[model samples]
Target: MLGGKSVLITGAGTGIGAAAARVFCREGAAVTLVARREKELAGLTAELTGAGHRAQYVLADVRQRADVARAVAAATEAFGGLDAAFNNAGLAAMPGPMHLVDDETYDSVMDTNVRGVWHCLQYEIAAMLEGGGGAIVNNSSTAGLVATVAGSPYIAAKHAVIGLTKAAANEYGSRGIRVNAIATGATRTGMLGEYLDQDPGREPAMAGKAMVGRLAAPHEIAEAAAWLCSDRSSYITGATVPVDGGRTAR
Candidate 1:
């Protein structure tokens, strides 16, 4: 799908982001993994390298514009130029009523989930523009399309991601840039596992929301993301693809 392409993936230490890195490499792309955890990034990099895939890792938090810029530059330096990017760094703030949420919780969630994507978009667009054009897939959520049980801040930030994706695609499609987003459902990620731990019933409850009657594996989401970054999805842009197992169908 992405043969010989240079790809950058953020939040790549684990979950959907990490899974996307492997998928992109398996499809013949050289991938650069970015995350806040150096240890995790190193371990994933070693694993990917051991598998005989061209892979590298950059330790950086997407919440910081400089860090995001550095990560993009590192990817370009490693692979010559960037052909694609998966902006997947995000966090779900504590779930509760809007009134119950405090300022700190709201700020933390918005800064990482909203501002983080904003930073990644800015640098990724710049890099892609230099190379002529590129593909980008932002990781939004089902909450982005509709109301969910997640915290108010998380829903708001995710909604903003879709907006940004559409705006970028509209602005750059004529220039050969395709920008899109995935509205993901509840997936089997470390964060989801922690959420399930807090309320064991929450797992089944979320799964029930999807028509598939089960939660998605991170790789499932990664596959769709990879396709979006590939030429196969060339005509697709300025849209939010739903990878929610029909959760939004209802």
Candidate 2:
């Protein structure tokens, strides 16, 4: 569905972001992967390129505006123009009592999850504008829609992501840019593994929250993002689609 598109994927080093790189390439997009870990980024880039996919990796921390700017430029220069982007770079703070959350933890979560998206939007939108138009998918969480067992900082950051998505979508829709978000549910990513490792018993509890009674596979979430970035979802904008296995439905 994304054939001939030039796509940018933040957090492309692992989890849903890495899955997105594969999915987007399979659907025929030239993908630019961005993340902080050079090892993961380079490995994924090599894997994709070896498979004959149009893919490249850029070492970047989405929290830095200059880094995001470079990532955008790389995409446009490599693939002709930016046609779509998946703003998936985010930080997940471990769950804890609200009052016990320290300032450092709060700042870190907010900066990575919220400010990261902010920086990405600013650059991605500009690149898309120059290319005449594009689609964008921000990776929010079920926490963004409703409170869960996540830490207070994570909840707040995800909420802000949805707000940014709506604001950007409303502002840019008429200009041919479409911005939307996915309210992701529990998934089997490294982040979740870390959370579960803290308390093995929590695994089933997390999975049980979903009506499907299982955590989502990374590719499942990536598939939703891919759809949103394609022309198939042309009429969709400023909307938060829940890919949460009915967790929010309850």
Candidate 3:
């Protein structure tokens, strides 16, 4: 559905971001993969290019506006213009009770989750405006919509993501830029695997929270994001579409 589109995917080194990179390329987008890890980004880029997909990698930390601007420029320069972006770069909150969460942990989560998206929106919007229009999908979490079993900083940062989604959507919808966020549920990402490995018994309890009785695959979340970034979701903007398996419905 994204035929010939120029798409940028942040956090493209692993998990849902990596999944989105593959899915977007399969759907015919020329993807620019952005992440902090050069090894992962290089390997993924090579894989896509080897498969005859137009792909490139930019090593960047989204918290820095200069890095974000350079990444945006790379996409537009490589593909001629920007068409869509999946701002999926983010950090998981460090596990701890609210009262015990240290300032360092809180700042890290907020800077990566909230400020990262802010940086992306500013640069991506400028690129889109110049190119006439585009679509953007920010990766918020189910934590964004309601409190969950997460650190306070994570919950707050996610809520900020949804708020930013609404604000950006409202400001740019008239300009042909559609901004939306995905309320992602528990997914079987590498990070989760590590947690589960430490306490295998915790899996069931985590799965039980979702009506589906299981965790989501990275691709499942990626599919939702891909659709949002495509013309298929043309009328969708300023909304938080839940990709959770009824976790919030309860």
Give each model's whole-structure lDDT: 0.94, 0.95, 0.94
**Candidate 2's C-alpha lDDT?**
0.95
Minimal lDDT window, size 10, model 1: 92-101
Error of 1 at 242 (Å): 0.6
Model 1: per-residue Cα lDDT over 90-156, one tens digit each: 9986558898888999999999999999999999999999999999999999989998988899999
TM-score of each: 0.98, 0.98, 0.98
The numbered model that scores best in lDDT is 2
Give one digit per residue, the lDDT tens place, for model 2 in 7-76. Answer: 9999999999999999999999999999999999999999999999999989999988899999999999
Per residue, candidate 3 scores C-alpha lDDT tens digits across 101-193 of 898999999999999999999999999999999999999999999998777999999999999999999999999999999999989887667
What local lDDT does model 3 show for residue 117?
98
How well does candidate 2 match the true structure in TM-score terms?
0.98
Q: Over all chains combined, what TM-score does candidate 1 have?
A: 0.98
The segments of candidate 1 whose C-alpha lies over 4 angstroms from its true place after superposition are none
Residue 106 shift from truth in candidate 3, angstroms: 0.7
